[model samples]
Target: MLEINGLVKHYGDFTLNCTMKVEPGRITGLVGENGAGKSTTFKAVLGLITYDAGDVTLLGKAPSELTEEEKQKIGVTLAESGFSGYLKVKDVVPVLAALYPAFDREKFLGLCRKFGIPMDKYIREFSTGMKAKLKVLAAVTHRAEFLLMDEPTTGLDVMAREGILDLFREYMEEDENRSILISSHISSDLEGLCDDIYMIHNGEIVFHEETDVLLNEYGLIKADEEQYRNLDKEYILRVRRESFGYSCLTDQKQYYLENYPDVVVEKGSLDEVITMIIGGEKL
Candidate 1:
């Protein structure tokens, strides 16, 4: 449902060059460390910032040139959204609802109630978690088909986070035409929810893979010098040696599992993958 081709955005010292596509009914996670250009890429996609080159198409129309109807079809919850602190929750909800043609007031109010958000309280007085919840509530109540959420679960407790995730799951099931692009530092949040992951580093997309493939096919191998020497170098993506042994990252876990049954093949997490990428360690 979304296509980005050779998207290039340049700042004075950093640049973002990325390419990816999101099909209907899929959740694509964009992950990277702080200042890794994750937010820059998101801004470019939303046309909030101008890019030097490349094209961004959201549901077939360039985001920069999207019509009002097209814009209504997409919902965005950024880290710093344009919500005035002086407005009370009740006032804010209706104000945002009026901007969208398909907004459901009842649904909005219901979500607020379900999340225990006080409708009468000013946004400035709410906790960080409450503000985050309000932003998500505003985004989803409009019934947008595409959601670009940057850390939607930020400041939320475990229960609250899960509830929000469940809401996204339900939204997907309710409409097969919907899609989402979620960027969060919490790898666990993306583990089960994202169909695929796009790992960004130094303003470039370093890795893009299906979530299942990533979890099942990738592994970390820790071995001694003798064991490391016995293994084929071609199979290792990165190797770091210590006083006692070496730690290696590999994509071909099955190969090592079959050949070196004695070698340890522990499953790698999304956090590990991101760490490796950010550290400039091979793949």
Candidate 2:
């Protein structure tokens, strides 16, 4: 449902060049460290910022050419959603509802109740988690087909975060045409939610793969110097040697397991894979 090709953005010292696609009924996770260009990419797609070069299409229309009605079909929740502190939840919800043609007030209120956000109080009186929930409630209440969420769970506690994730899952199940692009530093949030992941480093996409392929195809191996010397170099992506042994990141875990029966081969998580890719090992 969304496509970005040859996206290039430059700001003197920092440069971002990324290309990827997200199809309907899938959640794509945009992961990277601070200043890795995740926000820049999002802004370019939303037409909030102009890129140096590339094409961005959302729902078959270029973002730059989209009308206000077309733009209303997409919802966005940033790390900090700007809500006037003077407005009460009761007043804020309707103001947002008036902007979209398909705003569902009943559904919105239900979500607010489910999330335990106090509708009677002004936004300034709410905690960070409460305000975050309020912002998400506003975004989802309109029933937008596509969502661009930047750290939607940032200020939320464990329970609140889980609730928000469940809401996303429910929303996706409602229609096969709906899609979401979520950007977050919390790797665990995307582990089970995203169908595919794109890891950005140095303002470029270093890796983009199906989540299952990554979990099943790669692993971490720890071995003594002699065992390390015996390993085939082609399978290794990175290696770090300690005084007594080495820790290696490899794509062919099964091959390594079969050949080096004595070495320890442990399955790697998404976080570990990202770390290895961003932080090159010292040999």
Candidate 3:
């Protein structure tokens, strides 16, 4: 489990103030645009970067206070860095076995083979999907209880991405105590995998919701200017003007379905919800 309270980081122009928690046995996702501080938050949690304010607790201790043995309980895969493309996939087996006492060589090699990674082929010769799969394989095969993954499925095709996700699901099922905090640009990826979602923008977390609630209860209401004037506004969270009239985002979709039968109400997708929250006029 990981907990971050008031974690703040500042760059020249952007200041990141993030507070989020990843519970045991659950997959939590962070979604935001470029420069939205998803990576900054992950780095702070993993002690890869220094923060200006707040505290971070990882696996029951402050990130800085975790011992060497304690560090082995966590796994990491970053979009920005990892394995040297100069070496073959087989080349890192010994290095990993030497680093982690619990490294499962058999499982690692199995995952690599399952993902179609050529053990004899140099990493540089692999495609983007192969590289991404290799990174995730390395993270999970170490018997780590917690994972901090930044864009593990980036640039991957649909099948490749699903394979990695299935790996995560398998990892969690093997141990209910395990947890994963992942960030992705792909909405469908998060929608399919995350238990809950946190939306961050401009270096701040703006919304958090259970995935079921978000996908099931949330809706967008399309109403013209006349309908908008008469429609109940209590449940509406955001409103945006369209040439057709107004597009409103609401969490209580059932409430409107029962009260106003004429307005067009459509179930909200993750992308539509995020777009509306970031760009629409909040009520």
- The 0-to-1 C-alpha lDDT of every candidate, in the order given, reads 0.85, 0.86, 0.92
**Residues 52-114, model 3: lDDT tens digits:** 999899998888888989988888998777799899878899989988999999999988878
Query: Among these predicted structures, which one has the highest lDDT?
Result: 3
How well does each candidate superpose onto the true structure, as a TM-score? 0.95, 0.94, 0.97
Which pairs of residues have clashing backbones in candidate 2?
Answer: none
RMSD of candidates 1 onward, in order: 1.6, 1.8, 1.0
| Tens-digit lDDT string for candidate 2 (133-186) | 887877777878999888888889999999888888988998888999999888
Clash count, one per candidate? 0, 0, 0
RMSD of 1: 1.6
**Model 2, which residues run further than 4 Å from truth?**
281-283
Q: Once all C-alphas are superposed, what RMSD does model 2 give against the true structure?
A: 1.8
Model 2 lDDT-worst window of ten: 274-283
lDDT, candidate 1, 1-283, per-residue tens: 7888899988988889999989999999988877888888888888889888888988898778988889898888897664798999878766777789799999989999999999888888889999899888888888899999988998899999999999889888889989999988889999879999998888899889899988998887888989988987686777766576877877888898899999887897788777655553553
